[model samples]
Target chain A: MVDDEELTPLHPNHVKVLRVVTALATLPFVIVALVLEVRAFLFPGAFMVPVVLAALYVVLRIPLRRYHARGYQMGEDRLRVVKGLLFRSDTVVPFGRVQHIDVDQGPLERAYGLATLTVHTAGTHNASVTLPGLANETAMEMREAIRAHIRRDTM
Target chain B: MDSTAPTPQRTNPLGMIALAAQGLGKSALPLVAAMFGLRDEFSGIALVLVALAGVGGIMAVLAFLRWHRLTYVVGAEDIRVESGIISRAARSVPYERIQDVSLEQTLLPRLLGLVEVRFETGAGGKDELKLAYLTAEEGARLREVIRERREEEAVAGVAQEAGAEQDSPPIFAMGPGRLLRFGLFEFSLAAVAVMGGLAQQFDFILPFDIWDWEHWMELVAGPGDWIAHLGPWAQALGIMLALASLAVLGFATGIIRTFTREWGFRLDRTPKGFRRQRGLFTRTDVVMPAHRVQAVQVGTRFLRRRFGWHSLKFVSLAQDAGKASHVVAPFAKLAEIDPIIRAAGFEPESDTLDWHRAAPEYRTDSMVLVGGFFVLLALGLGIFVNPLLGFAPVALGMALVLGEQVSWQFLLHATDARQLYSRRGWLVPKSTIASRVKLHSAEISQGPLAQRRGYATLLLGLAGGTLALRGLPVERARALRAAVVESMTGTDFSELR
Candidate 1:
């Protein structure tokens, strides 16, 4: 039945992690724009610096919106992940179908005490569904839960 | 030799020769081309001959080293393969993990009574293990041993009977007459294209410049002059005759291609599962277990539909020659294909299905999007290029829009208690029937426009292939997802086999 259950958001620290990543990714373009503005190559104006800053400011705020857009609902025997703004995707993976579970941490995620949980299924497309930005402990607990479910089903 | 013992055994000794010969054959084309190009220079010819000899020697030595190093041990729990002259890499696959075992025989190996055995693990292409040039008898025995071992694991303490090899009556077989008709529908002009490409590639060998219009004119003058003198009616007749010949050539090429590919095609239901054997020059024998099949696809072309002909393919965990789905019946009447579909534990689609069309808003939005793009192109062309040329795009756009409407009419989806069905396409209609229990996951996706239009696309995850039901109302999409997830969670997958 179509139950309207609110999805649980990621750890609050993930927003800080996303913000740092966004700024790091945008640093190069900001520097390039500043250099071009100082050189004043083809077009002579003080507009390039201001335009680049405005773009950077707008992009730096996307991480928060992205974090807000992503959420997950762990059902009794299934996990539902909803994400994306422009192109929303709601995926449901039943515990019975999961082939394996993984809890991995990237450099930034480890720094923020966050990890990514991935569930691999036997299907070719969408064979692995990843839900990132979970507290490291939570990720491990979820992995154990799914593993127990798989073991019980096999038994 | 004990079959079940963990003794490492080498493949047939003759495989060394076969591997070397195969390597040489691969290089023969370039070697011959180089020799031809250097025919005028004595030193160049000598260089090419020496190079050929060097390559042949290296190939022979490498093949011998490879055959010597490679060995397989059919252990009780798993099959281990060790190879790589310098690296010494060894890999083992447990019997339970092997999805299927297939045998292939190219011309040279067939003549030598050898077959290439492939063990598919359902882990994609790179994971499959292959043993080349084994005796045909040995290959078959090995396949049986693996099958029995897997079955033993699936049903503990139940020993399967061995060496039965009983020939069951084929469920589907294509005779010469049936193949001829099928070939007629496959008319193609690829041979003409191949000839043109060859002529262009080796134009230097021609006495005249093939691309020079003057040369072609001169060559045709003899025939052209005579036709001109015969009168206008005779000229017209000659042109008609030439067109007819081209059509005949296309049909002949198609017939030849089909005959070679589908010669002696037969499909049988064995205790192991479905066994398909086909091909004229390079025969292949593949067996797919019924439980490994995730879905069934029934497809037909526009003309074939009118003739009641359809093709049946199985979306199985095991890959078929790099393809996601295995062709069970390439060309058969619906009546004939129905039995095979049923044999695979799938029911043929009946007229009583509660088919639902895609949301009206989705169709309208798509039409407007497609039509608007074409209209803009037409405007740009009319303003920048010739107005007459612009009219062509507008006409093309109109035709495309009409096609979209027709396809939308045919796009329907339905679901029964055990299966999910989706049918799409107008010219080449394809209907997929997937078992709910076999589905790994369900995804509901919506692009920006679809979100505003209140429709979503539901993609069902199958093992080898994917089944998508597009343009469903968002409410219905969620409902379907709930239904599919319920069915998936209710079943115990371990009991499938």
Candidate 2:
């Protein structure tokens, strides 16, 4: 983590966002599994442990660990995003290669005055690297800075 | 919405009519079906006409509103688009980032004497900016302007980079004979695969009962007929002959399909770019500028590689569907492929060789991955039904894994003044070369096996594609990743090398 300390942590509210998104995403499958559990012919309680473990991981462990683990750095000419605790990935994108930059806010983000900055490049894998849970103003400033770099590089 | 916005542009008014027509077509089938099935009074000519007119008018109005709301402006250095009916959004793509502006005219647009102008930005996902309908002349004008700008940039790029602007003249064109040879060499089993899939889906396609011996006997010869007079060995020989004929038929069909597509195939150099004209009936003509090209890939099957034959493709941002990635060189001799690579302004240090071999770990990784996949299949089958056949698959997998280990001897990487190269694989070995300038992002990933082997997979992401190089030593991978990131900052667009 101390390779270079330009890393910026996401907002604390991001944990709440992650939890809600995970709960909503898992809701449908859990409901279906609950119904299936009653009629299941083979082992009646076979799914219970796996289901509970997955739910606990999704709702509790993941959002907490992941939120703390994720950090991004915005330089004048490049952006570095460090993510994942167990399967760690450090992604760096140059401004010259960035085709465009956008500051996007969803309804939840809007409520918290938070936004995510997505930097798009020509790359297929890791093309649109999104840095979520920045202050709305910070996201806009980052977008402008990246855009400025892009414009300057083009010229 | 702002009046101060400069140089606002809109699609042709006829686009509204076309949009309405499209909407009508989508709903027409269901509307017609329900009207006939349920309503007697609606079947009247006057009533149907009135209803149709009403729907069409509403559609036309909606299209007009959308047209009115959307506007794109060609700025000094950016193309700014403002759109959306209820919620407004403005997107500005700088001219430098614009890969290509292509003009497409499908049936409706062509019939209307209009065109669709698409701007390909070398970005992920929603990479295309489309202006649905414009007058043919307007579309052409936009395309020409973008091309001119790109040409200027290329010249400027070359001049600033201290490289001479060398535009190689018309190198080679595929004659009909050459095209025929190219077509024949391409081992496309898509046709046979489709037929086989359909046969399995609908068993009636298979004329004879495959399992029943009596049914097969009837197919070969009626009971007490001439084939029955022949021995069982003769019947087996007849079946072998039938299989051979089927194989021959599949091969011939594939050849014919290739000929149809490459009938008028032509590749020649234009003043500022490369021009590829092919297709028998559709007659596609694609113009690829040198700078717009992200990477060059040369591929060849194991059999074709023995004969010095290979296929080449250009990874570009152009939305030339079906033709986009399968381009640069469809199928040709390695001798023929070299010039195209050079023509694209990427000349490797040594044309024929000087490829850096991969680390020894590559062999071990390839063995584990490919062989592991096969062994997993074997294990699955063993658990389900047969244990005896599982041993054979496992043995075969081991042999194949050994072959893959040998293939690592051929795994190579190279870098020249302009590009980075990676050549790997044995079954369908491919050589990939990308301009150093085109590299945007990169990552290092390690799986459980890689972690144990003390190596990591390096993924270099360019415009429109990603190249993954596995089994690099952990330290080397880290160094390469850092170097890549450093080079991205250290070098300017012109000084890619």
Q: For residues B1-497, what per-residue lDDT tens digits would candidate 2 score against the true structure?
A: 23225669888989887777877777787556555654566657766776677667767787888889888887666778888888998889877677667666655766787877778774633656878788888876776666656657554654332112224334555667776666666656677788777777878656665557777667666654776678798779888998887777766776777776666667776654677756653344566776667788888777767767777788875656744464766768877888888888876336664566666776767878889898898998788879876887888898888887777776777655456778877667878887766788877676666667777777887766668766777776666666666666665543441
Candidate topping TM-score: 1
Which window of ten consecutive residues has the lowest lDDT sum in model 1 chain B? Answer: B159-168
List, residue by residue over A8-81, the lDDT tens digit for candidate 1.
99998888888888877777777777788778875754656676677677666788899999999888898898
Candidate 2, residue A65: Cα displacement in angstroms equals 4.8
TM-score of chain B of 1: 0.92
Go through the candidates in order and give each one's C-alpha lDDT. Answer: 0.87, 0.72
lDDT per residue, candidate 2, A16-110, as tens digits? Answer: 88888888888887877777787785587676657867887889867898899888887767888877765666677887777778889999898
lDDT of 1 at B36: 69
Query: What is the per-residue lDDT of model 1 for residues B52-131, given as tens digits with 9 covering 90 to 100?
Result: 87678888998999999999999998999999989998999999888788999998898899999999886667667989
